[model samples]
Target chain A: MYLIITALAAAVATAFWYKNRLNDKLHLGALCLMYWGAALMWLVDCVAAIIAGEEEIIDTSLNAALLGICSVALGLAIWLILLLIRSRRNKSQATSINSH
Target chain B: MACFAAPLAEAVITTVLMKRFEKKEKMTDAPNESQAGIPWSRKLKWLNNLLWGGSALLALEHIWHGEIIPQFPFLTALKEPGGVLPMLGEIATVGVGMAAFVTLVWFFMIKIADARAKKAAVSGKTAETEPCI
Candidate 1:
């Protein structure tokens, strides 16, 4: 499950980077967010395993939910950021057009 | 039969819904304007429909087949209930996780599509708002 989450994270980050090549800043920022979420999931999974005293097997669902929450949060944040940027640009263009 | 059939049925439903959404998105982004047809909101509505349908399937499957709790020795000290509460909780958690994961994937798809559209919109410098606007 960790591998699944990692792979999904990688896929998402790659897609973001590829799609946003015109904006390297947004690409890196989104990638960092994904990686941070993945890293946090790994940390939580590892710590939970240690606390469980079950070194042989680790629970994947706990980490899965954590990662899911992180993904939703990051996705919403990205959507909001993009929307804000687009609206501001539109507003600025509208003002310029009006002035002209 | 809700155990095995439910998941497969849900998968079929999800596939149909996703394809419908894709079609809506395509039509919405087309150059030809046609507002008298299907509403544009259906593009995202189908995605939400998938999440709800998928969650229902996941919950039903988990309740019917999934284990209620972790196999921890300490937790096992508590008497297990033959009732439905344990299954409900487990299924609820799994369903929520599955739905959230799918929603995240849908968001990623939307972001990629939006980015591509934005790039296309800027490249030719031709205002193509007839369809989307």
Candidate 2:
């Protein structure tokens, strides 16, 4: 479920990036990369499950999902931290401009 | 079903809100050349926030359900009857629906922004550039 959701999100983000490639920014590209990375990780897990057979596929998939969720969460955290720093810098710039 | 629906719904709602806020920001922030052509960056930021917020909520939900134990092979809770199939089904339905919704909204936003730009051009406010994506 997490896999499908992130994959879908990644697809949408990628399309947006493609259409606006000339004007793309680092953070946006990072976001697309993050979701695509998560989706790819889950895809590997799915492949592993196929190799493991039915008896172990369930356990393997569950573990994979957990790891996928964790990775997504970590990616989000990093993005948010970056966003906050950017916003703060922008704020300070604006304040200096106004004071001048 | 609701379990999966929760994250999908959250993602959509957050994306909408973030997009709205970004639009407001663009309007107030003066049309700099650097920002003018990069409308998709705002959309990307919104989508990033949605994904991050949704993932965090889902993690908390999993923890509440006791699916995140410290033991090896954690998430044994998902091995219950019916397993992850139902959850996957719900995610598929909701994810597709939300994706379609966001796409439609994005298309409309571009359309409107283009129209407004054309109007500006006609009124001699600004020269018409390429349509924003």
Candidate 3:
């Protein structure tokens, strides 16, 4: 199970990384794949910890909360990075045009 | 301890990188995109830093309460299985966990940035500059 999750995460990450290089980018698909990868890893790890009898590895209620927060944070990070790149380019272009 | 240290260091490095990027943006003729010096992306760094810190706390809990310590020991605190110290060392494995978490965040950010940059470049917004007369 753990290996399956790891393999899935690795595959998705690799796909997105490759998609980034493609001329016709499939960003939304990449984003979905990335989240699925993360979710799978998290799920597998949590289950492994349970099987190992280290259920305390991540205190259940708190772990769930943290996972939610982490997901939101991940999304925010992605959103902001895209915005930054876009705005940076916009600003650069505006400045050039104004000066011209 | 070692587990938490790495993520914390990565956060610091990322924070420093963001600051440097901001300074460079300010020095250049970059358009102000109307959003002051602070980009929303910085929020992501802050969020990641918080998550790393939180995970470190979780790791500590596991170490303090987990079986590893009871499994092995330097000196036989408990003659049978062992002292908690040797088992506690397994907590160091949390470092690998932390790395995995951080990598996920880094990859997401990088992917997003790359996509945006590529989009801009393809739109010809970046490659062709209007005369800054």
Best by TM-score: 3
Which RMSD values do the candidates have, in order? Answer: 15.6, 14.2, 12.2
Docking class of 2: incorrect
Q: Which ten residues in a row have the lowest lDDT in candidate 3 chain B?
A: B124-133
Two-chain DockQ for each candidate model: 0.04, 0.04, 0.06
Deviating ranges (above 4 Å) for candidate 3: A1-100, B1-5, B28-91, B124-133
Best by DockQ: 3
With a 3 Å backbone cut-off (N, CA, C), the pairs that clash in candidate 2 are none
TM-scores for every predicted model: 0.32, 0.36, 0.37
Q: Which runs of model 1 end up more than 4 angstroms from their true locations?
A: A1-100, B1-13, B19-83, B125-133
Ten residues in a row with the worst lDDT in model 3 chain A? A24-33
Alpha-carbon local distance difference test for all models: 0.45, 0.55, 0.46
Predicted candidate 1 versus true structure: per-residue lDDT over A11-83, tens digit per residue:
6665665555555544343343334333333343345446658664434677545644454455546546766
**Native contacts conserved, per model:** 0.00, 0.00, 0.00
Tell me the tens digit of each residue's lDDT in model 3 across A1-100: 2223333444555565455544313233333333443443344356556766884654446545544544445544564565577678889999999999
Per-residue alpha-carbon lDDT of model 2 for B1-133, expressed as tens digits? 2233444555567567777767777777646433353355465554444444444444554564576566754554355677568656545654444444444544565566556655665555543443232
